[model samples]
Target: ENFFDFCIHSSGESEIKIKLFFISWHPLIVPIDEIYANETGTLTVCRFYTKGSLKDYIHQTKPTNSAYWKRYGRKSLSRVCDLNQIKNFGRQILEALNFIYDNGLVYGHLHSGNILFDLDQALPIKLLVGFVYNLYF
Candidate 1:
């Protein structure tokens, strides 16, 4: 449930958006400026700016079938997906996995909660978060 959240900018100058993640592996996370660990607390928190997560793209829609009804129960937060979208999503995920594999790292956490996306740019990109287990090649 604990994931990246945008940080509030207190500076008067134009500030870049920042995100915070707790107890994360440095390699798996996106490029970060700093990693601060609190010695007084048992949990470790990491602060960095990320494009954002796939959760931003989620939108509520009416269910169209029994399967959707069962899965979503009337109203669904899952947006209407087309074949191209599904294919693109699959390709993005595959590319992410390939990148990890090429870097001699294997990601064991593959789930919706771990999948993050950047849809604001001209060409949207997806990333996998929550590196609970990673194996080196």
Candidate 2:
């Protein structure tokens, strides 16, 4: 079965000041694999996680579990998680947040949607993408 493999997440405010931060690698931060630009703004490319974002995981599985991706996608990629799994996820989120703060940066946007789960791993499974990444300040 086919899954949602790619998508372009758009933001209105184009901050050209962002630079330098994308070069380094961090376990909790989603690495900028490539960046595409246009007249309006620029968009960064990262892996399309099989399990998708944490927001999708929660919203899709709860209640009736009717979402197409949840229902028809490969069951192996997603699982019936346990309490300890949740606690582990929480710990990773904190680690990501700590990394941001330690670098003297503030992540203004923090939410479930900003966090992603990569059931198919190249790196750690959980990662943060949405951060106030204006590094050229």
Candidate 3:
């Protein structure tokens, strides 16, 4: 709950935005009112998202189930995807980290599951980047 609360308030400031921009270029890092909670301290109201984490997308690939690759099989899907896409993903992650580090904050937990896919957009990566940007910055 504390983490979620921190994320909510953290995403609301301009300073946080600058910090986020420096850390991760990825927009998914932006915080959202995806999840909400009631706390016991002075800050009783909190908001966050329960939708899911990025790790879900990264770990989608499974040895037995090649179908998972359709979503995020980094290697096996190379035939259809170019190196640029892969590089972009990596860059986005680094940007996110940079934002966290620049602000003296630590993501603490990171994985493919934490990364999420935005199905509504033509480019999911762009959408996620925007989402994260709005949330934290």
Q: For candidate 3, what is the lDDT? A: 0.44
Question: Against the hidden reference, what TM-scores do the models get?
Answer: 0.48, 0.54, 0.40
| Overall lDDT per candidate, in order of appearance | 0.42, 0.54, 0.44
- As for lDDT, the candidate ahead, 1 or 3, is 3
Query: After TM-score superposition, what is the CA distance of residue 72 in candidate 1 from its true location, in Å?
Result: 8.7
Ranking by TM-score: 2, 1, 3
- Name the runs in model 2 displaced over 4 angstroms: 1-24, 35-43, 61-81, 120-124, 133-137
Sort by lDDT, best first: what order?
2, 3, 1
Each candidate structure's count of clashing pairs: 0, 0, 31
TM-score, prediction 2 = 0.54
Candidate 1 residues 1-137, lDDT tens each? 12211111121111211122321233334443343322221222234325444443453322222363454454545676689977877777777667655543345567653555555654355454434222322
Q: Which residue segments of model 3 deviate by more than 4 Å?
A: 1-26, 34-81, 119-137
User: What is the Cα root-mean-square deviation between model 2 and the actual structure?
Assistant: 9.8
Maximum-TM-score candidate: 2
